[model samples]
Structure formats: structure tokens, C-alpha cells
Target: MKLATLTLAATLVTGAAFAAEIAPSDVQFDEYGAVDQSLTGTPGNPEEGEKIMTNRGLGNCVACHEVSALDYAAFQGNVGPSLDGVADRWNEAELRGILVNAKKTYDGTVMPSYYRVDGFVRPGNAYTGKAADDSFGPLLTAQQVEDVVAFLGTLEYEE
Candidate 1:
């Protein structure tokens, strides 16, 4: 009985320690899954997107996917496919959906949701946004996601 009680207590403590909550207002997507709607009407700035991807504290996309353009990016993650020619493979809508939540299209994928504000494990400390007690918020704002997508579009297969 004592062991069981100790185990349960440990579980609760661990869960709370990792349970970094998102801002109550941060829940942007009413739809928990694939976002079909184009969040941004205006085209995003590819240059800005590139910066976010490179920023370790922000998107830090290079941590998971390889991008040749970011030649100086260090410790590129090898889990996801390379982003060399992603534009050829997916359109803007498709890209947007993936950016919002890749799990909607490809379930069981390791890719984290860029715009999603829900369903996170160890979201880490609240990095940005206005929230109480430093609770976390969306990894990237809607505009940021669009910008990253724009930059990704610049990557195309060379003949």
C-alpha cells in the first residue's frame, strides 16, 4: 500500500511539473486538427521566416528538418525530410495545414504544431506572449507560420 501511494504521488508531481499551460486566449484554432482556411491573405516575408527557423528560441525548425539554405544552422535534426524542395510537393493551403498541425494530415508524426495552442507535452517554459505565471503560448504566431511557409516555398528542386 505504501509503495502504491508513493508511486501515485510521484506521478502527480511529475505531471504537474511538466504541465505547462497555454494562455487561455491562446487557443486560436477552434478546429483541433487540420486548418484548411488560409490564416493570412497577404503573402508572408520569406526572409523573416528564414530568421525564425534559424532562431533556436523560436521555430528552430532546423532542429528537426534539414534546410540547405541555412548553411550555417548547427545540429540539424535528421528525423524529418529535408526542406530543399518542399514547394514542389505541396501547395500553400497544404503547407498551411501542415504548419498548423501536421498530425491532422499525417497522424503519429513527430512534427510539432507551429500554430496550435493545445495538446502539448513539456511545452517548456512560457517562451513568449502575455500570460499569467509564465504559462506557454503558441510556438509561433499566425503571421510567423505564414512567413515560414513563404520561405519554404522558395526552396525548389534544381534541374
Candidate 2:
């Protein structure tokens, strides 16, 4: 029992240390609310972005927005607009800004800022019900935001 407890403690400590190492996002929005610069200086993988968007524990974007490409997800939400031909409507920079922080683009939007860290009213650690500490980072990592942007870019109108 002692060994198990020690192992769990060690794992938690390691995880916390890793989480603390995540640097805050440096993305800057343009006057048009577009993030023309890449947050991580790395191009995102659309495949990984798709996984993040669909996963309930992760992005769970379907909870608020409907994506016809993600038809496999039941009960895609309607709170947000249907993401059909989103790429045709917005460019990559604009998509990046929206994924990083939608309110910057559209005021009064209910969309959560995936890459912002400082402005939340009562931020908490993931599912812990504990007030977030310095170790608490943005809702999504910089790369994760890029990935989602890449994924959204793929949602072209399937005509």
C-alpha cells in the first residue's frame, strides 16, 4: 500500500511539473481579430485536431458547434453556427484567432478562449473543483489550438 501511494504521489508530482512548464501563449490578434502568427512556431496536424475536437474530455467543441464532417458524434450542438464551409468563410489566420479566442473576433460570443489564461472569472483545475494555480495553463496548448485551427480549415463545403 505504501509503495502504491508513493508511486501515485510521484506520478502526480511529475505531471504537475510538466504542466507547469507549458509556456503561456504569445499569439497576438490583429485589428481584424486574426492571429496571423503561429502560436507554437509549428504547423498543426489536422488529424490530432480532429481527435481533440471530438473528444468529450478535451475540446468537446461539438457541445456548442455543429460540424457536419463529424456526423459520427451524436447530438452536435446548435448553440454555435454550423461549421459548414467554414474554411471558405474564413482564412487560416482568422480561424486561428477564433480557436485561440473567439470573443476577440465576435464580442459577446459564448465560445471559450482555447489559448487564453488570464481573464477567466473563476478558473479551476481540470475536474478537480480546485481553484487553478500558476501551474494551470490555458484551456488548450498552443499546438492544440493550431491543430484545431487546421481541423477547422478542413471543413470545406462538401458539394
Candidate 3:
């Protein structure tokens, strides 16, 4: 029994450390809200991004926007503009900013920050302490942000 308790305690500590390492603690940007300095060598994958876009627990982007690449989604939100030609409108860095936090580009946008971890006035209990759910932890990892950006980068108004 004591050994089991010790093992569990060790596991919890290790888990917390891992989470702390992955959660982004700060938001960064360059002029035009385009450069996502956070994105490093972790290459984005459009295929994986499509899955995240429709995932309610992940990006859940379909909950608030329409994307041409995500036609199979049963319900695409209309609150935001269509992403048919998003790439044409914005470049890679711009899309990164939008995906990371649209507020950087559009001040009053309802889009939540996928990779921002600070300045939340009053977060919920579920997001109060845990590294995976904290006011100083981003909603999505850096890789996830890059993946989504890569997918959006492919969209363009085919005229």
C-alpha cells in the first residue's frame, strides 16, 4: 500500500512537470500581428489540422467559423467570416496571429486565444490552477497552432 501511494505521488509530480513544460506562459508578436515567434521547428501538418478543426475538444473552430476545407463538418459556425480565401487575405504570420489570438488582429473579436496564457481577468475553477488549464497556459499547444495555421494557409478564394 505504501509503495502504491508513493508511485502515485511520483506520477502526479511528473505529470505536473510535463504539463508545465508544454503550456505556453506568454504571448508574443511582431508588427502586423503576423510573426508567431513561438512556432519553431515543429512543422505544421494540414492533415492533422483538419482533425483538430472539427474536434469539439480541440480547436472546435467549426463552432464559430466556416472553412472551405472543413466541408464535412455537420455544423459550421457563421459568426466569423468564411475562411475560403483566408490565405489570400492574410499571410502565414497573419494567420498565425489569428489562430494564436485573433484579438491581436481584431481587438473585439470573439475568437479565443488558442496560444495565449495570460491576462484572463477571471478564469473558471477548471482553468484556475492546472498547467493544462490555467490563466497562464494557452488553450492549444504551439504545434497545434502551427498545424491550424498550415491548414488555413491552404485556403484561398478560387475565382
lDDT of 1 by residue, 1-159 (tens): 999999999878766643543332333333544344445544579999999999989899899899987889988888989998899988776777788778877889989877766455554455434343445456787778879888988989988
RMSD of each: 18.1, 11.8, 11.1
- lDDT digits (tens) for residues 56-99 of candidate 2: 88899999889988899888999999887899999999998888
Each candidate: how many clashes? 0, 0, 2
**Global CA lDDT computed for model 2:** 0.81
* Off by more than 4 A, model 3: 1-23, 36-38, 123-136
How many clashing pairs in candidate 2?
A: 0
> Which ten residues in a row are the worst by lDDT in model 2?
123-132
Q: Which whole-number lDDT from 0 to 100 does residue 43 have in model 3?
A: 57
Expressed as tens digits, the lDDT of each residue in 71-148 for candidate 3 is 889889999888888889998888888887778788888898887765565577655445535335577778888888
Model 1 segments beyond 4 Å from truth?
A: 1-36, 121-135
TM-score of 1: 0.68
Q: State the weakest 10-residue window (summed lDDT) of model 3.
A: 17-26
lDDT of 2 at 96: 86
TM-score for predicted model 3 compared with the true structure: 0.74
